[model samples]
Target: MSQTNPMPNSNETPTPMAMMQMISSRWVSQPLYVAAELGMNEAFMGKLVDLEMPVIAGGRERTETEYRPLLGAAGFELTNIVPTQTPLSVIESVPV
Candidate 1:
């Protein structure tokens, strides 16, 4: 009689979430890779990067007060402006 191993294969397929995360990470990191290759990352050093946030409150608009403190705590200041028809109910940001 031949002996058989009972452990699962180490090369098992990835789950749906794992696959999605891999794909999304590749998509998001590719640009960064190119930027680094082109020396753009160094050029943008010591600059304030603009961050965007989308706020939707049950089909109603929300005030900056609702998000300012949170962003402030994280070292970001509210821009006090919302883009028109951007699908985002509110946009907030902080300087990194």
Candidate 2:
């Protein structure tokens, strides 16, 4: 009798069904934490990045609320936003 594997064959390109099964499975995905210079004017450093990022990198700084939907759309849940003494804030998220 041929055994049918429940896991996807990594050699082959993953189909939408395989991807969905992986997500719905009991596999625990790793969390993502990003320490970014967010748009908080606590030390004036955040304002600097907020102003310069758009001109220099064509990316604007974002608030925690602004990042919620953005991250959520990518299958991650915005768990926590921890602010440091500096302008940087740790944005924590877990995969859904």
Candidate 3:
């Protein structure tokens, strides 16, 4: 008779919430990747490079929403239901 190694197993399953988090992480990563590819972070950083404001956010003017889809492709999103020339505080990265 040959000796066999004994293995221990336990019942541990993934919860629905855990699975959801995993799925969401993948979805958000795509957007982040696109944002990085489009140089979104560099663009934003350039604007703030020289500004005299508590917080630097500029050059957000006259952007055509027509290219929003392109931005989506690059994992970037800028949405504002209100019609104003104001720029919202947004950075290029994974959206929360």
- The number of the candidate with the highest TM-score is 2
State how far residue 8 of model 3 sits from its true place (Å): 31
Q: Give the alpha carbon lDDT tens digit for every residue of 40-96 in model 3.
A: 475675565445243222322334454365445544454543332223333342323
Error of 2 at 39 (Å): 22
Question: What Cα-based lDDT does every candidate model obtain?
Answer: 0.42, 0.62, 0.39
Clashing pairs in 2: none
TM-score of 3: 0.20
lDDT of 1: 0.42
RMSD of each: 15.6, 9.3, 16.2
Which has the greatest lDDT? Answer: 2
Tens digit of lDDT per residue, candidate 2, span 19-66? 434554524244233455556566587567778676533486688788
Full candidate order by TM-score, most accurate first: 2, 1, 3
On residues 14-86, what C-alpha lDDT tens digit does candidate 1 reach at each position? 5544433443444323321111223335335323122211222323445678677755654457675545332
